[model samples]
Target: MDSKAEQQLASIANISNQKERTTSYLALLSTLFSSQPPSKDALITLGRHFVTSMSMAMVVGRRVLGSYVIALCAGTSMDTTGTASITLDDEGSGENQQFMQAGINAFKSSEGEEVRRDVVEGVLAGGNLSGWCEEQTTVLRHLYAHLLQLEEDWLGAAKALMQIPLEGGSRLISDEEKLAVYIKIVRLLLECGEWGQAQTYFSRASLLIHVTKDKETNLSYKLSQARLFDFSARFNEAAQKYHEVSFDSAIAEEDRLQMLKAAVTTSILAPAGPQRSRILATLNRDDRVHSSLPPSLSTMLRKMLLEYIVRQEEVKEFEAGLEDHQRATVEGGGTVLERAVREHNVGACGKVYDNISFEALGNILNLDAENAENTARRMIEQCRLRAWIDQPLHLLYFESRSSHDTDAEAQGTAGGLGIENKEKEVEPRLWSERWDDRIRETSIKVEALAEQIQQKGLIPPIPA
Candidate 1:
């Protein structure tokens, strides 16, 4: 830093006003990096100072420290993915690298993975932990977990986070902070597509968030669950959850925008049905989408959605702009949009055409007669489409009623649910049905436990 800059920092640090100190620090960071970027050595020095200073206060008084560490972690993006990022983001790579190195220098040189661990171990060996309060210990546990991430032991870190102890029945964190921790773990699991573990942590997060009654955390946690559902191939469920989350006032504009986009994307991939139609319809009339999204992106989403719900026609111009991955249908055997269109067209025919020729079906699904016939067979077999393809007559017979009642009854659905119907089903069981079953099961178990208490004369029972 320039001499003048150092003098400014000195003068600002001397100020006793909390707000002024904060403003000064913000200004300092901007000034320091706004000019030519600082060297690693300069960042290391600054980082060591910050780490030492913060540590002194935390250890001397044993503050909760989560806020300080969390702020530091956020600046470095360590909390974003539950791992220390090896490379810096492109847009602000230089400035971010400086910030990240500062975080690193607090415990270790930029090159040493064992930096935080060593500092923490030293603190523990010195009996520093013995004096720390639960919240303070919580901070150390979080720090140690993050340090494990720098070593690429992210799964281990997640396990450690889950195991952060309680002295009695109380937890070390506030309700909101506890929810945040669970969200962090869930996101980290999502990074590596660990759907099972992500689901587990998200389930816990959903429970923790209920006690606070904060709409923002509630909506954000729903977004996390939606992402997990998306990965689990529960597209329609994810789409519905994303749609709900998008409309919540508590979500930030950026996240809400992304949530809306995801809603449109997943809605297309959801099995063709009235549920899909409802999602698309909701998105179509929402003026917020048009006003909030970029013109090109809004147009693309609209075009893709229209292609599924109403027009399953040729989309060459639209397809031209997509990248190879977008064009490729790796998830369900066709490009995502393509699968949506094909599936929609297949389901739409039951409503419009009771008996259509293979050639006509092909035109609607954007396939050749032979290919369309094959697709119809696959869908019928999978119980996604309620129809039969007659090769001899080169025709498809769309049933007027339940196909299962016919000579060639449709088998159970793709996931062993009931047959596809005229209005169409979303998934194996309606989400509501699943919840009802869970609640009913819980009620029965509770009743059984109550009976056991009364029958066995187990400890004093509650009033009737």
Candidate 2:
């Protein structure tokens, strides 16, 4: 056997009961290192050997064996690109496909799909690079990332992808490809509410991708920025970013519309009046909602929310379009129709009724007086509505303005939906303030580019 095979054997042989694990690794690595042609049978047998080793290793708590398997797989790559992406489902009858299919059939009659998935997961869990050589570390990480992906473990997948050193074969994986995959996995975690783990990956993807100047990458960075705000509950900022995504021609229309709706929906949940009106004005001008194109459910629902927020009177119109599931997606575990009615009441209360008893408020909102009070309390607690519920009087005092003014432009409104505070505060952000931010960011980028040029001696350094 070659030095590599001998080293692999010695590595696993230290374990208390190394016979089973040793046999599997020896056969696999022997085939991998042999002078003979790299056959499909050998590759398939290696996969089965990997499974047997892992299953036994897992039983004995000797997952260290799987790490060696990862190293072996790294050196081999299962020759997968030549075989794996082409599944039996594909119509092609190429030589590689036939061989891969034959391999699958061979495995199917022995160890089923479930066992194979378990083996992949075991390798992923055990493939840490604590003692791996420098070259093999990159190869191992590339292999590990795919294994994690197969198991749908996005967080692990992102970390493994980033582990590939830039100088190796792994570096051939461009910033574009790596960031795209990394961002996707992070986004999945973000959507699934795994914030603690997801946040680290998001920041990593952002810092890495930001230095690249690709339009698609920039869009991805922007999407990540939007996700940060959305997940953090910075409604106005999140909505603004989502709105930007909606208009980006680089993104698909279907994706853009979903983002647009997310923008408007989150906007409605922003402080009422000018903040909402600003988003509403943008949505109002976005004739896509009223376009003659085929309406996806998200587009249709987004339009419903848009109309409901702007009109603040058509509770029935909005409710009419909702299916049971859509209606049930309201915050506080209430139906959308129910929430819409409460929102209509809040808007109406802000505009028409300054201070009203709970029973009367409920009548206007089409709810019983007690339920109205409870709903108002919940909405108040959630900061959804600017109001205070008086238990003694069974009354709700609609707040003159949102008690907090975080977004600078959020303070002002011309229409009678609520108070009109036109003075822009330094603390809050308006569209003009956001534009200034853009200019500052652009200036920074230009300065950075100039510094890069000067450092390379391409041009004389600028005087301080």
Candidate 3:
């Protein structure tokens, strides 16, 4: 056997428990190698052998073997121009119909467009006046584009494109031509909410066609898939896919930013029950959720994640407290234990207040003295411990002019009044208000921090 064949055989042999398969492939490779300037028949035989072998390997869960088989198949030679873009004109003759049918069949079954294009080009270049080249070329290009759009048939389209002859074999169309085909396919699938299927096609097309290998194409495809998954309530899958495309090395920074935006937006909309939990778990496992994003973006996402966790914990605690309060109120019926429990809960609230250094809590109580004073006091304590207000607060305080100041102004007095005017402080009531908002804000912070750790860890995005 030739050195290449021997190397392939050795590589196969090294894989676990595939000696028999390797030997069989080696024998086939040797047979093909023996034929100098190998005949088309010999090439076809080798190709068939490799395809069958690879299919079997996959069935046996030997992916490594399958990969090798695929490599062999990729290197195999077939009729480069099987589907000639030539239309034979006949005056309403059955032969014309037959020719058209043959051409269509060849187009459908052709393994790769580039290969088919080669065959067709060779036939046309042979100086044969028998075939119609112009009509066939146009029709084939259109068919190529159309087939590429079908989500379920993308693999077939890729195989077809690879066979097409470019330059002399098949015409080299514009990037717009290829893009138009993909766009049509994606739009159709998207409208039908077949995002997963659409994405599969989009990715295949990107890999197969050079024209589709752009930042816009990748970003659009990934973002669209993310949206579809998000709408379907598949948060984890959506987030994972988003991370893959958004942080890809091939993608430009601007595109990455756009992807990040989409990812964050989708994460926010993700349902907070089991779905969010699963997504977070997946993110942790993949290390994508915590990895290096744009500095500003990383900070934001980390903050979000941290805040989310904190809010979730707070909710659980509150729910537990509520349940306990209800149980005690119902079972104790004015008993000493019930009173003691109530007192303990109230005292716990006070302890929380003493921990905060900010006087904003006091200010809130003073403003809403009549109705919100007691609740405000309880919240002040809760904010100190549970609200995580350890960082500098960014709240805006609004103050009102005192009565003396108004009187002094009316009297045309420029001098200052003895009493200072008080400002209305909008302190973030950490322990009270809409539960959803609190949870959302906290989650955002946590997610942001988690993003930071992930980037610092230097982890790759998880594969699909």
lDDT of model 3 at position 463: 82
Clashing pairs in 2: 327-336, 408-428, 408-429
Alpha-carbon error at 193 in model 3, in Å? Answer: 7.3
CA lDDT of each prediction against the hidden true structure: 0.57, 0.52, 0.41
- Candidate 2 yields a Cα-based lDDT of 0.52
TM-score per candidate, chains pooled: 0.51, 0.51, 0.25
Full-model lDDT, candidate 3: 0.41
lDDT of 2 by residue, 1-464 (tens): 13544455446546566556545554554444332233333333333333334234432222333333332343222323201111111222232332333334433433333343343344334443332233333444555566556667766766665554443542244565556656755765664456566677777676578556778667867887787776665666887899888889887778887787676655644444345545555554567745722344235334433333333344444445432333445555455545644664565566556788877876766678877787777766655566665576777777565545433234243442444555432233354765586599999999999889888999875689
Model 1 C-alpha lDDT per residue in residues 1-464, reported as the tens digit of each score: 23554466558657776555654554555444332223333332333334334323322222112222332343332443222112222433344445544444443434333434554433323332332344444555576667777677777667667655532534334566667778877876776667698898788777777776666556667777888878876778887898888887776788788888777667656665455655565566578768876564456455444433345333444455443333445543567667766776776677667889989888877678888887777777666665655567898877566444331122212322333435444233354764586599999999999888889987676689
For each of the candidates, give the backbone clash count: 2, 3, 59
Q: In candidate 1, what residue range of length 10 has the lowest lDDT sum?
A: 407-416
lDDT-based ranking: 1, 2, 3
